[model samples]
Target: MTVIVRDLRTEDRDDAERFARSRHRALPHLLWTAEGTLHLLAHTPPAARRRALVAEADGEVIGTAQVDLVHDSPEPGQGCFTVYVAPERARRGAGTALVRACEEHLAAHGATKLFAWVLDAPAHRAFAERHGYRAARHAHFLRLDLTAATLPPLQPAPPGVQLRPAAGFADDPRPLFALDLETAADEPSDVESGSAGYQEWAASTWEHPMLDRELSMVALVDGVPAAFSLAHTDGRGRYATAMTGTARAFRGRGLAKLTKNASLHRARAAGVTEALTGNDGGNGPMLAVNSWLGYEIVATEVRYVRELG
Candidate 1:
């Protein structure tokens, strides 16, 4: 069978659907949707040089790759890509071909270091090693059965603190943006991510199509946005926490846990059955928090990196 790699057809719904299905099959704990994929393709900053690529074998979409530079990272020349093949279609050379295409595209865009995520499975690690990528830290995808698990009871807000839905900030989300900037800078990652301009964050994060503003919770201390738990939904009873963080001064007060717990309760009441989140293996505080919320690790992915000569 011959494998062909090419850029995704932005206007093709079938193409987008197939790509999203492949991703969900490969990493089911996280949310995936055709509309979200299309929105991402259209909203990505131009400086990122983002490309959504797919692999075809025998006229069927078998694998997919999203390639782009770490445009907002404090460090330059860093490229990132994630490739996943339908489990049944593995070893058809689709993964390899997609990787080659991603590397070529990123290198052309001046990327000197390429980072890829490989599932922790043995075969996946071997494939990455064969491509000259070395293993790095790993992250876990966690899942909670909102229908069965008993979420922690909501607690009264601490003095001067109030719980609010992210929707309340729709008229002016600048405060959330500022909070995101503060929290994102502190997130644990292999690459040091930095926030782009406010407009860029608005297009890529705040205004995202999957963002469920009503389900996303925020903790305000005396009218100041202190912590948040962002929610994203696929409209199919699947909900994922897009991000959860607390401001520097608000870290020890259990504000993150409070907002996230409230968000989960709201989501469950709204008919969301499955809630998903991902955390760095080194983020013990968050890992403990999710465990307390009854989330279990469903899958793990290792970060792999290679330096381009």
Candidate 2:
């Protein structure tokens, strides 16, 4: 069977949906939807030079690749790409075709270093190694059964701290942006991410189709946003915490756990059956929080890097 690789036509709903379905089938641990796929393509900052590629087998979409420069990183000439092929469609050269196309695009735009996330299976690791990529950091995807798991009881906010939903910041989300920027800087990763500007965050995160402000919980200390848990829902009974963190000054106060627990409670009350999240393996604190919330490690992916000449 011949496989053809081409750029995704975001304007075509069928094509977008097919791409999303392929991603879900290939990596069920992550949350993805047709609308969310389109939003990423549409709202990606121009500086990232993002490209969404689809691999077609005969007339069906069988694989996808999200390729872009690490525009938010301080390092120059860095690019990141993740490729996923439907389970049934693996070993048909679809992945190779997609990677080749992605490399060519990134290389043409001056990317000297490339990073990819590959499943920790033998075959997946072998594929990356064969492509001259070396393993780097590791991360895990966790899932919680909101319908059955016994979540910790919600605790009242500490003195001088108030818990609220992210919706309260609708009129002005700059505070959330500030908190996100601070937390993201401290996240463990191979490539450091630069600040996410307010305008960019507004378009890509605050206005995202999957972001559910009402289910996202935030904790304020003396009327100042100190910790937050950002929630994303697929509108189909699935919920995921996209991000949860506390300001540097509020880290030791257990605000991260407090906000996330509140969000989970709200999600469960709203009939969300499953909850998902990912954490870098090196992030022990976050992993401990997820563990306490009854989230089990469902899958692991290894980050791989390749140096370009």
Candidate 3:
């Protein structure tokens, strides 16, 4: 029997949800939803040429591949395809078929360099190496059981400091942007992420479909947004700590932990059962914070990059 790979139909909600579920089981770190998966297909820039491809076996969706160009980067011909098959369905050629279709589509659009993230597992890494991708940066996926873990006690904001929810900035979020840019300037990553323009950040972060502003905690110093714990939820009781950082000028004050704990407490109180977060392998301080908050290592993923000729 042969696997049939084709573009996903927006009307096929059940099939799309299965694809998303397959990805979640394979790699739980990523944030994905059927609505979000479909949104990307509809809203991604034309230059990106993004699409979601599903592999069907006996009329059942068995795999998903997200193919797109690196349009945000200044470089050209940089395409990427992240393929995930139901773990139980591997070795049936669904992964290979998805990758082949992605390569053909991107190559036709002038792609020479491709990037993909593979788990550090022997089999997954071997699969990527077989396809010419070399390992790059590695990151960790951490988790905390909100209902059972012991969270750090809240500390009163030091003199002149305050703590609040990001929803307070519903009218103006530029201050939060400044704080984000300041903290992101030093975030550990294989690919140096640039500061997205404020308008774009508003569109991508503030207006993102999954953003939970009420759960996003922000630390303030004399009325200035200085640190924050950005939160995202899947609307199904799963919470994720997206970012926790303090401004460079305020680094040693422990404000990041302060806001993060506040957010976590709020999440647990609001019925969020499981919380997820990720830390760069080399980021010791952030890792310590997560550990202190009862987050444990659940999985690891390695990033792979291939240069374009």
Candidate 4:
């Protein structure tokens, strides 16, 4: 039985479903759906040269890879390829084949540095090290059982601030875009970030099929978005905190917590059964916020870096 790696067929629904399921098994922290997987393939920035790949042996898909360049970063030539093989098929060289294929494709596209998210497990770390990757910053995968978790009681909006659904900005989402970009610029990360493209933001964010505007909540001060909790739902009771941040000027006022709490309550009201979010392990403030909101760490992953000359 030989395992071969190949590009994933974008139009094939079964392949996408299987890929998502395999990822779910490999890393339960992520909330991925077939549609979401397809969207990444269709919507990733062109400079990224992103591609989804599947590794098969005996006609069964056993591994998956999401390879792409970091197009949004100010620094160029940074790429990423996260490879995962189903536990049932490990040691079959499926992971190796997938990583090799991804690296070759990315290098062909002029990528100089590569990053991968590896689960914080001994074998996972060893695999990355064997491939010339070194562990960088760590991140936590948090989960909340909305069905049984005791969330903090919804608090009244502060004076001069109003809690509003993201739908309020449907006619014009530029405000949300501006708020997002500001928060992203201040976000904690190894790589410097910027978010200036309104058109790209619309295409990659506002118009995305998985984003749930109704469940998303924003804290408005004088009718302007000051902080927000971006929401994404998988059409299944699975809700994710895509982003929760406050504008720089709004920091230290508890607006982020306020907005996120509102979004969580709205998610529960909308029948979302599970709430999932991720935070950089170094981001103590946000982690504290999540803890106060009843989230518990479920899994952890470390970012691995590799430099190519």
The whole-model C-alpha lDDT of candidate 1 against the native structure comes to 0.93
- TM-scores, all candidates, are 0.98, 0.99, 0.91, 0.96
The lDDT of each candidate is 0.93, 0.94, 0.84, 0.88
- 1-309, model 4: which lDDT tens digit per residue? 899888888889998998899888887777888988998788777877889999999988899999987776788888888899989889999999998998898888888888898989999999999999988999999999999988888899989999989998999999999998888777778865456489888888888888999999899988889999999998889999999998877789999889888889989988999999999999998999999999999989999999987
User: Model 4: C-alpha RMSD to truth?
Assistant: 1.3
Error of 3 at 175 (Å): 2.0
Candidate 3 residue-wise lDDT, 1-309, digit = tens: 689999988788876687788788767766778876775676666777888898999988788889988776666678887888888888999988988898888888998888787777999999888877899888899999887998888778889889999999999999998888888879886553345788767776777777789999999999988899999899988998867889988888888889999999999999998999998899999999899889999888888877655
Q: Order the candidates by TM-score, highest first — what do you get?
A: 2, 1, 4, 3
TM-score of 4: 0.96
lDDT of 1 by residue, 103-185 (tens): 99999999999999999999999999999999999999999999899998989999999999999998999999999999988
Q: State the lDDT of candidate 2 residue by residue for 93-172, as single tens digits.
A: 99999999989999998999999999999999999999999999999999999879999999988999999999999999
Better of 3 and 4 by lDDT: 4
Q: By TM-score, who's the top model here?
A: 2
Give the winner by TM-score: 2 or 4: 2
- lDDT for 288 (candidate 1): 90
